[model samples]
Target: MAKISVLSPFLVLFMVLMSSAPVTGQDGSRRQMVPAMFIFGDSLIDNGNNNNIPSFAKANYLPYGIDFNGGPTGRFSNGYTMVDEIAGLLGLPLIPAYNEASVNQVFHGANYASAAAGILDATGRNFVGRIPFNQQIRNFENTLNQIKGNLGAENAATVISRCMFFVGMGSNDYLNNYLMPNYATRFQYNGPQYADLLTQTYSQQLTRLYNLGARKFVIAGLGQMGCIPSILAQSASGGCSKEVNLLVKPFNENVKNMVNNLNANLPGARFIFFDSSRMFQDILQNGRSYGFSVVNRGCCGIGRNRGQITCLPYQMPCPDRNQYVFWDAFHPTAAVNVLMGRIAFSGNPDFVYPVNIKQLAEL
Candidate 1:
C-alpha cells in the first residue's frame, strides 16, 4: 500500500457509508460471520494471555483497562485492542485468551498473543517466558484438540477449516530483538537479510498453521515501529528514528510478497495482508482529522516519552483517551484501535491489500 499524506475524498465518503451500515448476520439474526477467529501475535493483539506468565509484560492491573468493562483485564491498552473491535465487526464475541478458554468457547476461537513475542523463538528472550509465534501455534494446537474432542473429528475439521486466522507477528522481532542492544541479531544480519530470515521463518510458521486447519488468513503487516513512543524517546531530537524505520521496510514488503506467494501455493487457502504500516503513516499524517491531538507520546506512563515498559500500575492515564493516538508506550489507544478495526474490516485496498477482512470472510 502506498503512503498518503491525506485521506482521499472518496475514502472519507466510503468510511461514512461503512460506519453507517448495519452489521448483521446473513439471516439478519446477528450470527457471527466466521465460525471462529484464532488470533496470534505480540502485545498489539494480546488481551490477557501474558497475565499469568512470569513475564514482565503483564497488564491485568489498574489504569491499564481504564476504558474496559472489567478495568484492566491484562490488555495493554486502556480499552479494546484492534482485534476486539474486529471480533465485533465479524459479528463474533470477544475472543478469549488461551488461558481463559473454556470448553464451550473452544468452538469459537482463542487468542494466543503475548507481549514481546516475535516470529523468531529468541526474539523476546530478554523478556523471558513470552510465548513466541511457534509456541502460540502449539497453544492453538491444544485448543484444536479440545475442539476436536467437543465437536468430534469430522465436525471439528469442518468448523476449523472455515475459521479465520488473524496473525500479527514480526513487530517484536524488531523492537525486542534486532533493535535491542542486548541482542546479537543486528550484528548477524543487515536489514534486508534479517527480513528475509524472518519472512522465511514466517512462511513456514504460517504454513504450519495451514496444515493445522487455518484457511482464512488475515496477515497483519508490521506498523511503523520506529515512530512508537519508545523509539522517539531514544532519539536525541525526540523524533522518529530514520534508521529503525528503514530497517523494517524490507520486512513489511517481504510479508506482502509472502502473502501473494502463500495464496498461490496453498490450495483452498486465502490470505490478505493488512497494511498496518500505511495505517500508522496515515494516522501520523492525518491525526487531527481523525480527532487525535496527541500522537507522539503515551496517554499514560512515566519517562522521556512514556515509552518505558508499560505504564506504571495505578498510574492515571490522560483524561480523554479518545484524543490520543497511543494509549501507552507501545500500543494504540482504544479509539485508534476502533478506527483501524473498522477500516480493515471494510476499507479499500490502500489499507488492506487484495481484499479486506470482510471479503476474506466471505470467501
Candidate 2:
C-alpha cells in the first residue's frame, strides 16, 4: 500500500481563503500552494519500510510490483494501495517510506506503515525486526523536526493542520497476537476482554495523534479475517471460523463508537471509519462487479489455499491477475485497494464517512 496524508475538502477551501491575498512565488513561477502531509499505519498502508526490516511479510520480491515500476518496491501489491490512491487524489506525491532516507526531503509525507504492525505498540512481538507503532510515531516526530527546521514553526503548523491522517491497522493485533495464540492463555482473558483492552489502547494512541495536530482521520476497521481466503481454507469443510469472527465483532463495533466519541471530544477532529467487512462482503456478493473471478482464490501461491503461508516465491501467480480480488491470502489486490481508495475519498457513504474519501478530505 502507498502511504499518504489525506486532506479534507474544507481545509482546501480554508487554505484558498487564507492564500487569497497576494503572495510572491518562488523563482517567479506561480503555483497552487500545497500543504505537507504525514501518514501512520500498518502493511495495508505501508510503502516498503519493512524492506529494511527482517520480516516474512516483506514485499521486496518478484511479481509484487509487476504492474507498477516493473519490479517490487516493497508495496504488498501489483500496483498502488489505498494510501497511494488517496495521495494521488490529494495531489500529493507518493508518500516516501520511513526507511527510505534518500527521498525524505522531496516527498510531502513519509509512511510509518511497517508490515505486521498494529494499534498497540506490542501487537506483533514476533515481528521484532519490524518497526512498532510507538516507534513509527517517534519517527514521525523526528521527521516533523526536520520539516520544521526547513519550513519554520508557523508554516509547519499550517502543513500539519491541513494534512489528512490515514491510520489503517489493528487487524493484525487481533489476528496474530490475540486470537491465533489463544488470548485465554497468552493474555489470560476472553475475547471480549482482550478486545476492550485493544480498543482502549487504540483510542489512546489516536488521541495522541489528535493532540499532535492531526485533525482529519481516516480510520480503517478490521475486515472479515475469518472469511478471508486464508482463514476460509483453514476451516474448509469445517466451515467458517465463527469463534474468531465473534471475537473481532466487539472490537470493530467499539472502534466505531470510539471514533464517534473522539469526534465529540475534539473540536476540528473528523473521524471517518472504513468498515472493511462490508466492503469485502460487497466483493464476495458480486465479484465481477469489481473485476474478480474468485473472491476466495488468491493470485499467488499454492499452500495459501490451505492457509499455510503468504504470497512467496514458490506461489503460483494467477493467469488473469485483474480478475482476482485478493492478491494473496490476507491482503486485497491492488485493483480492489484502488477501488477502496476511490470509495474512501469520493464520499461514497458505503465505504467511508457518510460518503467517501474525497468528501472526508473536505470534512
Candidate 3:
C-alpha cells in the first residue's frame, strides 16, 4: 500500500479561505495582526517543555522532530503541531517551550504544557512524568508575573490581553488518569463523577485565566480517543472500543455544557469549542480524503498495532507519514495537527465560534 501525504489538500483549502476573503479582527485590524500567543496544554502543543523533565512523554529524541529541526525539539510530531500553526496565523513567531532554556524571552509567548498534563492536579502522575494541571497554571502565573516585572504592569497587561491563549489537554485526564484502575477506585469516580470533576476543574482554570486577563480562549476538546490506534490495537478484532467511546460521549457533552455556562456567566467573554469528534470521524469515514492507506495502523510501530511502548528504528516506519492520521499510539500526525490548527484558529462559524483565533487576537 502506497502512503499518500494529506497536507497539501488541507493546506490548499486553508490558503483558499485566506485568499477568497479577509476576515477582520475584533479591533478592526486585518487577520494575522496579533501581538502574541500564550499556550497551555499537553504534548500536542508542547515544544520541548517535557524534554528537561526526564519523562517517558518527552519527544526530544530521534524520529520525533527529525522532519523539522533535524533533531527532536520536544514536539511530539515530525514537525510543527497545532500550536505552531496558531502562532503563525497570529503573526507571532512560533511559541517556544518554557523548558527551552536557550530560547530568548523577547518573543510573543511560551508553552506551559507538559506531555501528560490534564485538568486535575494529580492526573497522569503514574503514566509518565506528568505535570499536573494546577502546576501548569502556577507556571503560567509565574511567567506572567515575570513578564510584568520586566515589561512593567501596563505593558504586560496589554500584551497578555492581546495575545491568544491555546489549550490542548483533557484527553490524558480521562485516558490515563480516570481510566486507570487504582486512581478511579481511589477517587470513587465513575464516568459521570469524572465528567463532573473535569468540568469543575476546567471551570476553575478558565476563571483563573479570566482573572489573569485572558478573555479570548481557544479550547480544543478531546478527539476520538477510542478511535485512536492505541485503543483499536487493544481489540483482538481491531475495532474501536465501544466502552471507551461511551465514556467519551458524556465527557464531551459535559464539556459543552461547561463552556456554555461559563460564557453565560462571564459577559463579553468569548470561548470556542473545536469538535475533535467530528474531525476524527471525518478521517475514518473517508480515509482516502486524508490520503491514509490504513487509518487504523500507526505510522510508527512494529508488527500489528503496537507503537506506544516500542517505536524506534528497529521497529517499522511508514514511508510516508502524512497519509496516516496518527503518528503513534496516542497522537495525531503532523499533517493532522496542521488541519486541526486551521480548524482551531479559523474554521466555519459553527465549528469555531463568534470568531476564529486570528479575530480573537484582535480583541
Model 2 residue 185 CA deviation (Å) reads: 6.3
Instruction: Please give the lDDT score for candidate 3.
Output: 0.71
Q: How accurate is candidate 1 locally (lDDT)?
A: 0.86
| Tens-digit lDDT track of model 1 for 1-363 | 233566764358446945674542112345588998999999998999998889987888889889887788888888889898888878888889998989888677899999989999998888787999999999999999998888898998899889999999998999889988999999999999999999999999999999988899999988888889988888898888889889999999999999999999999989999989888877776777777878899999878788865588888788988899998889999888877887788877877889999888888
Model 1: ten consecutive residues of lowest lDDT: 21-30
C-alpha lDDT of all candidate models, in order: 0.86, 0.70, 0.71
**TM-score for each of the candidates:** 0.94, 0.85, 0.87
Cα lDDT tens digits, model 2, 1-363, are 111245444323323533442221111233212354567777777779988667766888876776765478888887778787767666666777877855454347788888888776666667666676778878878777787888887887777777777887777787667765643324676777777888898888888887777777888888777766678777646345677778788888888888889989998888889887766666565565345676765787557463456777635577687788878777778877776665565534555654455665554
Task: Rank candidates, TM-score, best first.
Answer: 1, 3, 2
Question: What would you estimate as the lDDT of candidate 2?
Answer: 0.70
Q: Residue pairs in steric clash, candidate 1?
A: 65-72
Off by over 4 Å in 3: 1-32, 101-107, 185-187, 308-310, 313-316
Off by over 4 Å in 2: 1-34, 101-107, 182-187, 304-306, 314-316
RMSD of each: 2.8, 8.2, 4.9
List candidate 1 stretches off by more than 4 Å. Answer: 1-14, 17-29
